[model samples]
Target chain A: MPQQKLESVEDLAAKAKALRRDVLLQVYKAQSGHPGGSLSWIDIGVALYYHEMAVFPEDPANPARDRFVLSKGHACPAQYALLADQGFFPKAWLETFRQYPTKLQGHAENHYTPGVEVTTGSLGQGLPQAVGIALGLKVQKAAQRVYCVIGDGESQEGVIWEAAMAAPHHKLDNLCVFHDLNGLQIDGDVKKVMNINPVPDKWRAFGWAVKEIDGHDFTQILEALAWARTVKGQPAMICARTVKGKGVSFMENQAGWHGVAPKTEDYEKALAELAD
Target chain B: MAGMETAGVGGKVGVVMDSLRDAYGDTLVELGNEGANIVVFDADLAGSTRTSKFAKAFPDRFFNMGAAEQGMVAAAAGASTTGVVPFVSTFAMFATGRAYEFVRQAVGVGHQNVKIVATHAGLTVGEDGGTHQCLEDLALMRMIPGMTVLSPADALETKQAIRAAYAHKGPVYVRLTRDKFPRIHAEDYRFQIGKAVMMRPGTDVLLVGCGLGTSICLAAADLLAAEGIEATVLHCPTIKLFDRETLLRLAKAHRAVVTCEEHQAHGGLGGVVAELLSEAHPMPLRRVGVQDQFGQSGKPEKLLEAYGVTPQAVAAAAKAAL
Candidate 1:
């Protein structure tokens, strides 16, 4: 299914808001999942799926189509929401988010779910796979680009840096990574737990074309992605400053909601706040 | 089997000694020449693992992920999703131990078509000592669901095993030794994944082995034969898709069984044979391996003898089992 092009920022923002609601609803119904990171990443996921990527949900395995990897795979509710919205699978499968025998696993599983390009749950695995995909495409001289979204907290994994160092070394300009810097992990603040501070500087020093942007803003997200495409001889890293719970007020900037399901009252309040 | 002029049982295992990693590298070059959509990844050990040969032949298809086994494995897993077969090589110590989680999550759980050819397994890594030797790789790789594990006995088997690993779908781990090994499996020998070859047929005892341990079993069988104790030597190159039917049949025929491997007696081929026999056909068995101890720096030959993984050890174990 071809995604309807949203040329206007209002249209893209509206789509992202709807996705946020879907993400919360999936989490509320399942009474599980990482809401904070999902909320933080939905806008970027929305921009990639709806605005930037050349994906056909009908031909999910199209070799020419661009690929996306949720390196911080716990934020899969956002990806599932976007994938379902884009008609990769029936929208109703969202209700079976973390349910047993459901394709929509608690973490993104490529084998089980359509449009999910890689299986990821254990942190620090997804990005290197993205690097691999990019490297393979480069080897084939394929034009298709690879995009990956990683969490700030997930950066603590040594493998993440290993990928960070490798992508630039291979000159994977076809690859782009968006760091979802929401400043919170499960325990508390990412800085307090394990600071991956100096994020953009690290990426730049590692030879990536680095950019910092407001992750929730459609204009900046789209512009940064376009900028990433123009980069050559190096991978692109966009350090996106975002709120932990982006659209919902009560959960915003709150670390406690990192992997918590919304109570019924919280769900009603979140839904009311997300109303058009 | 041509050129098998009076050697080990089945007229296989000639006197020529060759390196398993060299065979692996040559097979990779052969696959590349065959137009297989194959990519090779090595974690800064291309020179040691012999994947540098592939790197030289096909630079575009080769990636030297500098000293980063986890990233190399994950990248290989990622690359496999694009309908390209990626063969990742690293020392067994780093490949299966340091970057174990990556292998489990990216390759095993994802069920991606990535071949992990871990060279320099077991104490045969020699002078590197225990820190660089991995004796538990077989157990680690086999325990992962949907993983195919193989440990080829010699250079000839290593070449065929690499081909077999590529032909099969999903994740595969091929174990190789750093040291040179005697050539087993004759020129016409075909390697069927998950099957064991009966090197020597006997009725008194059953001898099971993989990798260098298989060579030791052959020698042990010769020793047993001289002692008027006939033993069946089953060279089990493929450990995961274990030839249980053959093992069970041989076990019923023999009075006792003994398993040998250049690894820990608790895991690897020894552990696998123990698990299989205890469940299907329980019998007196002896495991000749490292006996659950760390290896120290020594010559490969001395290490094998010191660890009690030699033909003498296997022969002794077989006698004890009897």
Candidate 2:
């Protein structure tokens, strides 16, 4: 197959809206899952898997394929939708979400699911693994890139910065990290719980190419990812400004929905709001 | 006699590095020479963890993750996902205690082919005190599903365990000590995963030990023999996939059993043995390990003695149980 070109910003935005609807439907069906962060990361997930990355679902174990790690794995609904849409597995697998022995687990498992890359749920660990993949590719002189998405609250972990420092020191140019700066976590506002302010400057100080963009904007997301590809000497960090629940009005910026699954009425409202 | 013959074939003789951490680095460097896809990683303690030697020789393959044990483990998992065998080195305390979640998710849960080689295990870390020393790593790591836990008795066994871990196609945690101890294994004794080594065979009592405690068990067996009491010493290196058949046979053959290790009695070697014996073949078992207590700053030998991990303790426990 010929190299797939980047989709138009409007098309990608529409896809994000569709993904949000799918996420709400799946979460509602599962009767258990985090919907707030899932909605927040919909656009970012679409941009990476559909536009920014060079992975082929036909061969998920392709050594040259770009790696995408869902560090904030509680938002697995976003990943499940992206994987199904990308043809990693059958779209019908999404319906099996949270069911025992199903590949579509509440948290991602690389063994059962294709294209999931690294198994993650424990917060603040995906970036380190991403760094390792980038480092490994560099060592092998392979052209594969590694993209990791983490939540703003997950940034409270010291290991993330530890990996941040090591990535640039090793000159992992194939690494691009996106922080879902949704400003909310399970407890409440991230600022009230543990301030991860100056996120961009902190990453820049650690020797990364820092970019702050509207995570909901496909055009900006595309431009930032394209810029990251051009940079050759350092890792890139994109502080993606996002709402906790971007598509659904009632759940937007709400901390209660961080880990709580939406009820039938809430799910209907969320799906209706996300319908394009 | 068979163990001696295997030791001869492997060239397992004489003063090997008493510390398993040093053996890990040296063996990794040796394994790198054999054209294997071996990679080394450390969480900023390359020198302290003794992986600096491998890092110095193969800088391209060695990654210093800088005080991030979780990241180191996760990266190792990622590397393994790509078919590269990665040996992740860190302090046992941090690797097992702090990065437990990462290891469980990325390596254990994923069943990735990553080797976690941890140093400063048990009370061997000494003066750095309880904060640095990890006397409960074996218990924590063993609890992870599909994790192969190997705590080699000495340097030679450590080298062999590293090779075995590399050969094994799954997640393996090789716990190592910081302090130097006597190299006990004969040079050619083959180290096999999940297989217990019957160091000395007798019928009166069975002394099962792992890691540093194995050496103490050997000493206790010798002491028992000197007192005209026949004792058997079994070296149980693999805590996860332990040799159940051999353990049951030894339990039936011996009059009583004594388990020893430099770890918390709660979930360490003793707990495992006790659980096994409770179901397989019940026996009067005495446990000689750290008894629900924390360690303190002192010389490693002093700490071992104070914690009742010495051969005298094992001998006493064996006698009482008998």
Candidate 3:
């Protein structure tokens, strides 16, 4: 782990605000992407990249560096923003997101993007891959940890439970996964579509060290990550309750914004709201 | 040539047979012992897939991912990112069918170094019937971009194919059978990934085969020889990384070609050869295998005969092509 001092909560919050602006801009430019999930996931993504995870943007494939997987791949604008900000690629490339021949693919393509550890556009795949990386680290007796963020909606995939069951069975203490529990999916309420309620109980039953936190709160997000490090002999799950589309006044808690790209007028209002 | 005659000669019953999965399991142990940073994952079919041998040998390196092939395949892709070669196994149906998208996205698109050695392929899966037997695995696996597809003929080729898959970087899907098969390659046979082995050197017709189909092809060659129609037998184990040069060269020498496999005729070796010949050397061609139909429960040999995947069927197809 890098011994660099953790960024202050306020600074991290400001950076997340910038990332939020970047996310909205990228989605607006692409004219196609999941802005709601991106907004919901940005805060947690910021907390991991800016403070908790030991990731080297210069040498992205450093064996000792921590790994991250965006399992809910539709929300890639947020991850793309973070990678760009971290110097994983040129910041200008964010404008090319979802465009033809752009390296910033609509979904996370690990081979195309430098810092992205795994390709995960498909729902319910990242957790198992994270588990595999953790198991591989354990086999090599390496200290590098693995981090993954999954959409609450993505939990409906049966492979999630399969990975969830396997991690604890293998005693994968080095894996830390976060659930972006934004309470909404593309098809309206997640509850109506598929109720994954009692989320903490589910993780506990699956043999993970579980924590519930306000996902938007930088302190809570950071604290949960710190707490995940203290866990031993089992993987950690941080279920973060968050509004569907956070920060923007009109978008928050709105299922309609789940995948629809904001129109120019809506984009202006959203940008104004996120402006420093 | 006489050695090739031993395969599928006096029926599949009395002949000593070798299990492809047995060779696969033993090869995994061999690879593990050679200090290869290799890991094995099985989705609750270790006993059948023969990954149990590796699991017993390297208890720590082996992982039984339960019945979750999707998770197993994805996890193997993840493990490969960390520089460990992960060999995943399950019955052919689940490995390619149950977990197709995972294999496509994680291993294929991501270009991860994961070996998917799927056992229990084709009509040879016998009593399990069509649902368990995967006749379209070759087609499914071949469609994946950058995926190396292999269908070894016998035990010796199975072992060498495993080693080749391990040595090769990127994703590879190997198709193996449930039943023990007669050996087609000589003891001195050295396997190469893209090179086809010439089992016999006749020129009346070209008989192509992979997996159990190779033995069938060799038997068809013998049957054809007795009737004054000398045929060439080409064993094509690697379906995707095919020996196009050798195939086209042999195609030039022979009057016609007959491709055989235990898979659906639409997209296994037959489809591959058709696609190749249509572009390169279009000649009188006949694909001898299961027609577009599901297999039924029966004795393995009986199933082969019923599905029109036998030597007689191949010989007839060869004669028809000629």
Candidate 4:
């Protein structure tokens, strides 16, 4: 597939909106999914899959291509749409999300889905897996890099810290982690549930080169990813401040929207709000 | 049968004892030397688990995921997706018990080619008491979807089992013990997945066993032989894909069956054999093992004795079954 000319932030913003609508549609169609977290990382996912990451639809498993693992797997709708729109699979499968015999599982399964690199729904696991792949890629002497996107709520898991320490300790410069700090989690605010505050200092103390950015801004997302690509000895952790439900008005910052699909009337209102 | 006369018995344990962990490490080195794709992960038990041998030989391929078994398992799953055979190792207690769901979801459900060489398994992980000992590792691992569980009886089988796991694609749990076990197989012995090794021939009772208990069963066969009761000792290395055909033939040929292991009587080799026999061939049988009890701090040999995983105990079970 020929690489498209670099899309401006306006173009990325449009793609992210489409991706958000797709996530809402997927969840509403399936009657179940994690919409809040999925909506949290749309622009970031777009920046990676669209412009920054060296990936192609024809060569999904490109040996030298960048690998992406959604460690916060419940937010798979963002990735599922990105892969489909990128032509890795079919866009029609979006409607089939969470339905039986669909490649779009409740959570992404690596073997079942074409573009998904690892199977994850169980949180706090994908970071370690990404570290392993980065280490493996480093051993292969490949220029390929790994981009791992996890959630702040997911950071509360102990193994994520284990992986946070491991990647930098192994000197995995080829790996970059994106922590979507979407404050809200199930049962209310993440700070009140299990505070993973001081997220940047935490990664820095664990030896990661930290970068903070507005997750909704594709330009900032791309800039951090570009900077992350150049760092040679230590892994990069880009902490992106994001909203729980960025596009939809009713769902934004509400823990109830974390896993619930919007009702029909609310869904129509969300679609109209995103039309702006 | 050919090496029977020279294969001395009577609780002597003089059949050229070798450490299973050592063979596992040596086999890993051989596997690593053959290709650059073999990546090894150890959860800070490099010395105890003997994965340190692989770590030292292939430093680039080795990952010491320090004292984090859950992280190690998930990382192994991640590495396997990139076409590298990831061999994750830790004590069985931590690997299977502590990091079970990670193994189940990441490796088993994900269908990753991760070889889990968990050492220091069963009651033989002595002096550390019940916390370190993992008698239920086999049972827990066998239940994982598409998991291949192999508990080799001795060093020779351990090496072969490691190679077998590497050749096969999917999640595997190759259980290894801490202390050395008496060699029950010849040096020329080859391992067959899901097949039992007929260590000794008998006609009265079939003494089915695995891990170190196979050697104990061999010794028990000798004890039963002296008392005019011939017992066939079948060493089942692979507990999950157990050799059902061989078990049925031997069970029918004998008067009764007696299953033995250095594990819980409810869910180890005894449970597997009993479940099989009751449906297929319901006859009088005895399950000899650590009768639903946890192990305590003691010598490995003494723990085995206290747990009743001995030739004398197996012989008594065989007699009672008969």
Best model per DockQ: 3
Find the 10 residues in a row with the least total lDDT in model 4 chain B. B1-10
What fnat does each of the candidate structures reach?
0.79, 0.68, 0.79, 0.73
Docking class for candidate 2: medium
Compute the TM-score of each model's chain A versus the native chain A and list the values.
0.99, 0.96, 0.97, 0.97
What does candidate 3's lDDT look like per residue over A53-126, in tens digits?
88887888989798999999889999999988888888999999999989989889898888888889799888
Second chain of candidate 2: TM-score? 0.93
Off by over 4 Å in 1: B1-14
TM-score of chain A of 4: 0.97
Candidate 4 displacement at residue A170 in angstroms: 0.1
Residue range B147-250, candidate 1, lDDT tens digits: 99999988888898999899998899999988777776789888889899999889898999998778788888998899999989999999898888988888
- Give one digit per residue, the lDDT tens place, for model 4 in B27-49: 99999888737889998889998
Write the candidate numbers in order of decreasing TM-score: 3, 1, 4, 2
Model 1 lDDT on a 0 to 1 scale: 0.90
TM-score for the second chain in candidate 1?
0.95
For candidate 3, give the lDDT of residue A46: 91
lDDT at B246, model 3: 96
Which 10 consecutive positions of candidate 2 chain A have the poorest summed lDDT?
A1-10
**Residue B80 in candidate 4, Cα distance off native in Å:** 1.0
lDDT of each: 0.90, 0.85, 0.90, 0.87
Q: What TM-score does each of the candidates earn?
A: 0.97, 0.94, 0.97, 0.96
- What would you estimate as the lDDT of candidate 2? 0.85
Per-residue lDDT of model 1, residues A186-228, tens digit only: 9999999988889999999999999999999999999999999
What lDDT tens digits, residue by residue, belong to model 2 across residues B181-282? 667788888899999999998989999999877778877887788888899999899998998889998899888999988899769789899999999888
lDDT of 4 by residue, A18-109 (tens): 87888888999999999999999888988888788888787788786789999999999989988888888878999999999888999988
